[model samples]
Target chain A: MIRFDKISWSAGSFALEEVSFAVPAGSYAVLMGRSGSGKTSLLEILCGLRTPSSGSLWIGDNEITSLSPGERGIGYVPQDGALFPTMTVRENIGFAQRIRGEPAAATKATVGSLAERLGIGAVLDRRPQNLSGGERQRVALGRALASRPQVLVLDEPLSALDEELREGLARLLKDIQRDLKLTTLHVTHHRQEAAQLADHVLRLENGAVVRESGPPQNG
Target chain B: MTLRGSRWFWGLLAGITGAYLAFILAMLAATAVYSAPSDLWKALQSREIQHSIWLSLCTCTVTALLSLFIAIPSGYVLSRATFPGKSWVQAALDIPIVLPPMVMGLALLILFQTWFGRLLEKAVALTYTVNGVVLAQLVIGAAFAIRTMHGTFDHLSARPEEVAMTLGCSRARAAWLVTLPAARRGIFAAGTVAWARSMGEFGPILVFAGATRMKTEVLPTTVWLELSVGNLEAAVAVSLLMVVFAMIILVAVRRVGERV
Candidate 1:
């Protein structure tokens, strides 16, 4: 579960004012807003990439406001996938484990398994530059799940893909969330995606949550 | 006819420039080969020449390593963070590069001869010593390194380091593992240029370290010394050696830069 209570942050003229939301455990929550609605900012705040001026953030039982991004146990995949171009897909996927001092052999096994599950086993040796848009997204998703965090925060993950690829990945994401029972907070402006994938929806305007819909897809 | 004429004109222009570049290269090659076997060999066997070459290599290697160690962090901070006086710091880093080498040496000598010199001499000697040569080379070489690395760090987005940090690596660790690896080619090129600059340094070594045979003498200083003593053969040999080393380093840097 994830909860934000009265989170406020100011960057120059842009401000996230009194924002709040809650996502239940093992559910997909999509946040929809136009550009400059602080949707990315909210996700960044939850991921601990940006600090809120005031308010509390809770991931499960832990108050994550004081924690660093890594300590928050939240996997954040940015808009562009942000995969290291120099690293092979296998290496990129295993980066979180490598950072945490996991043994090389163990990391290899884990990454191999994740790649197989993501159907990216064949491209494991290739670099991110060589991967197609959908393939990159899958590799990025695999990388995020490598650490097995409490929640996954995806910021416009499907926005960069073409129409055909985005639709396929959207369904794939829903399937992954259901199969893994992973709690996910997906940020996007695409209402159709929200309609299809989200268990619930929160609309943001001027940095504040203005509306909430319950289990849109489940109904 | 018009299209063919334009194409011919462009091709001719390219060919002319290529021929001029090839002519300069041929001259350098001829000078190296002609100086190598007899004059260069005899100079290489001399104790003074051997000592100067050794000193040059040792000082250049140390300067290159030290400059890289310092430049990496400096470049990262300048590239990644915003702080007060950032522009001033950047401008200061470039000062040594633009200063004339002889002026740099003179300034170093004057600073060392003042109260600063006495203070440093108390701790460790500076003026007219091997350390002085190393210090001069370091000052110039580090500037070259920082300039190269600053461009490199600027070219890279900070996203990789940020991602590494989110993956449980500390800031320093992220810099080491991700940022440095991403800029590896740039770093290598910087080190090569720094070492080459140090090896070819003449004015700074002569002014600060005083061209002492078998003591503080480096390759360029040895060439200068041989010329002063009317040993034209030995001077030509040392110059040829320095030119060869510089060419090798430059070629390697170009190859690495292309790959990166």
Candidate 2:
């Protein structure tokens, strides 16, 4: 489980006050908020991209507040995918493994299997610039999973996709989550996406969680 | 003729200007090439000339590498972090670029003649040595590298490095593996420019290292020495060599820039 307690942070004119939440293991939680509602900030803090002014974060049995981002074992996928343009898709997927000092042969096999499962095997040689929005998102998802993270945090992963692509990608994401059985925190303002993908929903307004909805199936 | 004729005339005029500029550049290239071969042979055979060229290349390469090593972290910090006096730090990094080279050399000389130089000299002599030439080049070359790299890092989104960090790479490792690869072309271009800047450095070497022939004498200093002794051919030879190296660097930078 991933938990944030009494998190407070101020960035310029924006402030997040007393934000608290927990995402249970093997559950998909969606953070729903309008633009400028501090969703991105919350996501950043959770992923260790930014620190809370005051708060405690816990992942599993570990208090992650004192740990660096690298030590937190959280997988983050930014809104734009943020794929390294210089690296081929295969290399991009295997990046985290390389960082963790995984054997090159093992990394290659792992990336190949992931890419095949993600349906990006054909474009493994291409760079991010050549990949479509849907394809790039898949590669990003594959990269995050390659690390076998404790909690996967995705920031607006579908915002850049077209209507035709978003629905299919959402389903793909659900299937992947189920297959990996990984706890996931997905941030998006889209109500449809939140309703479709999340097991539970936390609605943010001006940086505070105003409403916490029960599991989507219960609703 | 209609309005279209006037537009065509403007286009023709622009083309003519471009042609003229190209012609002038070609002429300069021709002059350098014409003087290079014969003079270069004589200079190359001379032990003094060989030593100066070797020293210049070695010092500049070391300076470029050191400058890049330091500049990468500094540039990333300036680009990605928000700290007190960040703007002031940026301004300080850029100060050397706009300052006249002679002024930079003078400042170095002053610092060397004072407590800092004595401290370094106590461990290893800095002034009037090969090391001094390398140090002088690094000071200026690193400024150039940082200025170029700062923009490169700034233009890139920090999301990739953040992703890397979250995946268990430390800040330094994330930068080296993720951020550095993303900005590889920019860093390469910056290194090229820094190497060229170090190679052509005259003012700093002249003041700090005192232009000792075959010892601290870099290519530019050798050129100056040749010119002072009425050896125009030898002077032009060294200048032409510098120009060739500069051209190679420029082409390489252009190619890398295009790729990025």
Candidate 3:
């Protein structure tokens, strides 16, 4: 479970005012907003990338408001994937483990499994620069899942793809979330995506959560 | 086939570039040709030349390494962080690059004459010593390194470091694992340029370290000493050696840069 209680932030003229939401464990939450609506900022705040001006954040029962991004136990995939350009896909997926000095065999096993699951096993030896947009996203998703964090936060992971790829990945994400029972907070402006995958939906306007909806039935 | 239109225009520009290259090569060739092999051989075997060559190599290596240590953090801050008087800080970093080498040397000399420098000197002698040579080279070389690394970090997005942090690496680990590795090519380029600049530095060493024989005497100073004593052949030989060595290292570095 991920919870934000009365969280607020101010960056220049933009502000997130008293935003609050909760994603129950094993549920997918979609945050919808127009451009500059503070959806990304909210995601950043939740993942400990930005400090909240007030209030608290919690992942399950643990209060993580004061923790650094690394200590927050949140996996964040940014809007552009932001894969390390110098590292191969295999290395990129295994980065979190490698940095923590996990055993080589374990990292390889984990990375191989994750890549195979993400359907990016063939591009393991290639760098991010050599991968297509969709391939990069899969590799990035694998990287984020490598550490097995408390929650997975994706910022517009499917927005960059073509309609055909987007639909496929959206379903893929749902399957991944359901199979792994991964708590997910996906931020996007696409209403259809929210309808397709979100177990709960929240909309943001002017940096505040303005609406909430229960899980949508199958389309 | 007859060249026409933009082809001639580009050819003209290429001709100008070729002229510049030919001019530099001819000047060096003339010096090398005028110097007798026996004279060049004698200069190479001289104890003073030997000492100067070794000193230049050692001091420049130390200077380059020292510059990298300072540059990494300095460059990251200069590139990534926002602060009051940032423009002023950037300008200060660039001052060494623009200031005359003699002025820099003079500044160092004046600094050592002050109370602070005197206190430091008590800890370890610097003025007119080989250490002074290293210090002088570091000042300018670090400026080059900082500039190179600043641009490098600027060109690279900071998102990877943020991603690393999200993956449970600390701030330092994120830099060590992601950002620094991403900037490896730039680091190599910076180090090579700084080393070359340190090797060729003369005016600062002349003023601050005083070209002392068998002590502070670097390659540039050795050339000066030979010329002063009317050993034209020896001076020319040393100059050729420096040119060749610098050329080889620069070419190797460029190739490595290209690969990256």
Clashes of each: 0, 0, 0
TM per candidate, chain B: 0.89, 0.88, 0.96
User: Across residues B120-158, which tens digit of lDDT does each residue of candidate 3 receive?
Assistant: 999989999989999999999999999999999999998
How good is the docking of model 1, by CAPRI class? medium
lDDT for each residue of candidate 2 in B11-50, tens digit (9 for 90 to 100): 9999999999999799767767766576667866778888
RMSD in Å for all candidates: 3.4, 3.6, 3.3
How are the candidates ranked when ordered by TM-score, highest leading?
3, 1, 2
Error of 3 at B30 (Å): 3.6
**B43, model 1: CA deviation in Å?**
4.0
lDDT of each: 0.87, 0.86, 0.90
Candidates 1 and 3: which is better by TM-score?
Answer: 3
Least well predicted 10-residue stretch by lDDT in candidate 3 chain A: A210-219
What does DockQ come to for candidate 2? 0.71
Show model 2 residue runs off by greater than 4 Å.
Answer: A23-25, A59-62, A97-113, A179-181, A212-219, B1-47, B255-260
Candidate 1 on B126-174: residue-level lDDT in tens? 7888888899898899999998888889998777677777788788887
Better TM-score candidate (2, 3): 3
Instruction: Indicate which candidate wins on TM-score.
Output: 3
- Show the colliding residue pairs in model 2: none
User: Model 2: what TM-score?
Assistant: 0.87
Identify the candidate with maximal lDDT.
Answer: 3
As a whole number from 0 to 100, the lDDT of residue B145 in candidate 1 is 92
